[model samples]
Target: MFRRDAGLMAAYLVDAETGELLDDLTDHRREFDLELAHTNIAGDLMDLDASVGLPGQLDPIDLADSLLVRYENLWAELTRSDVFDPEDQYLIEKRIGRLNELGFDVEEMEITTVDNGKQVKMVPRVVEHWHHKRRLASLTGLQVQENQARRLLNSLNRYRIILSEQEGRDVPLPVAAYRWISEVFNPSVQIIPHDLKGGLDDAELFHEILEHRWYLSEERHQDVGMPYAAQSYVDNVLRQRHH
Candidate 1:
């Protein structure tokens, strides 16, 4: 009825036993499907899945263990043994760097005089860089982890710079990004044979290609282009890995 009324953009049929969507319905999902999948309710699913104790599923205890480790690590890094002087110039940068190293980005920081106005206390408002994941998805139609998005964006920025240098003018980011997607990224991905994809998604595959390119360039002491690097990656890395 919804399809007849043109109200349905897509539909899915899932196998209840396996929790897998029907293969035939894979193409029916809209562009925003992945974005929707990563919403707040995804956390609830993760928690439920963890508790279910299903084989090959994420373990709740393990998840808690990892979170505890990360919490302790952050606490250790942010905690100071002695009071810092209010005028310390490098403290902010140092704190920001530590947070960034832990896969966080500081959006705002509040530093106020404390300890009888002799020392300062610093509090940072941070994000886990989830915006990078969203930005990459919106721009490129690719959903990837935050670190992978950061890596891809770094590569895109480098591509933009080279393009600007060649054209002798600053190219806007969105424009350069489209060009990079068409010319560099898509082409490199196309070179990977379907059978040899090794179950990796597009973003992960592209990241591996970039890593392979860097490794080959360093080894050969020259800039090996994307095509060459991609072919080499397929032959050496992808072929060698078991699916």
Candidate 2:
């Protein structure tokens, strides 16, 4: 059943992924549908598996509901208090930092002076995740998670510095990205065996290589290059999965 909302028929209870009717909205009554598809919800909700790393078998609708509750609770905590001191210069930065750490960007917000200008009230009108991933995609066209993008970006910046030093001039980001993609990223990714591709994507594999490089550098008291690090990871670490 559907209900008229603003002169439109809308579903009250439906399968989110399959869009199958579960209940009619006309009487606000629940209807059970047994033939709906079992796939996960489409679009951003499907990313929950990779983002939250939810283990074991779980229904998509249950996962989506849990995430919704989590976000709702976080929003309540962030905006419930309207008694922030306006005199603290670092308060805004602190809030923004906290939001970023929680994997959200304040897309739109409103700040108002309250209590005769003694206090401040802030409300985040819009929030977005994938902040680093969006920027990285725009620059390098490589889609990855926020943490993975950050690691890849650090490596790209290092590659940029290397290029500048080698060429005796400042290197632009696009040029550096092109070289880094060809030399560092592509080569490192290709070293992974085909059978092991199921474990991690290219960006994640590269991120692991960066971590391995740091560990090797610490052990040797010198920087271990990417090529050596990739080889060692594949030979010693990844090869065990096949056996």
Candidate 3:
């Protein structure tokens, strides 16, 4: 049996004497191979695939729900029209970038030349996201998020003069990232323990810690550092509260 949609190709063989199933393939054509004799079947992981949904099936409603959801999303993306003018070329790029940012890689834009090429209509043909994470890892050694890595690199750009001036060193970009991560963000984040911290994410926790540091400094009329801020947060705020 083969399911092209699932990229699954498998062959079933009946054991004549033992009345069992056997796999007879040498090389793999798909990620999984399945063998079944009546109700007996096994795939790579014994996948309960969609072919079970006959009129005599137990859960036909779940299958309909899944198909409805898939169709809904595809219909929304493909059929929905923003429908703008030719003068707004910047909006097209912005729209494309927004879709790409939302984890969709646009394959190509279908631009319609209406009114004999004077007017235009464009629609997205494809979209994909989560592409930047691997690319960022390749460009830089860090395996942080695409957005986080992008922001980190941007923040590092701001710290170029700091690296040159205070320590009197002009480091390379990768080394500078290391220095910034170690000296700035790491120490701040390291002060917070896993148990003491609430549901805040790492980057957000660091950012809030920085904000708390500034707030503590303003309140106490002194330069409260990250560690002190984290300590105070753990003691004064988190301890008193429950979520």
Model 2 per-residue lDDT tens digits across residues 36-63: 1213343345577557855675656676
lDDT of each: 0.62, 0.62, 0.49
lDDT of 1 by residue, 1-243 (tens): 112212322222334554555544342352244334444345655668867754677655565456546755666665443244433322333444465565445432333335642232333334432566887777787778876776676566556645664676767778988998999889999988989886888889998987788777667655677788889898899888844
Using TM-score as the yardstick, the better of models 1 and 3 is 1
Model 1 weakest 10-residue run by lDDT: 1-10
Tens digits of per-residue lDDT for model 3, 145-215: 55554444434443443454445454556676677677767776777778766777766666555556656
Angstrom error at residue 22, model 3: 70
How much is 18 displaced in model 3, in angstroms? Answer: 77
Clashing pairs in 2: 1-24, 1-25
TM-score of each: 0.48, 0.47, 0.35
Which candidate, 1 or 2, has the higher TM-score?
Answer: 1
For all predictions, the C-alpha RMSD in Å is 17.3, 17.2, 16.5
Model 3: ten consecutive residues of lowest lDDT: 30-39
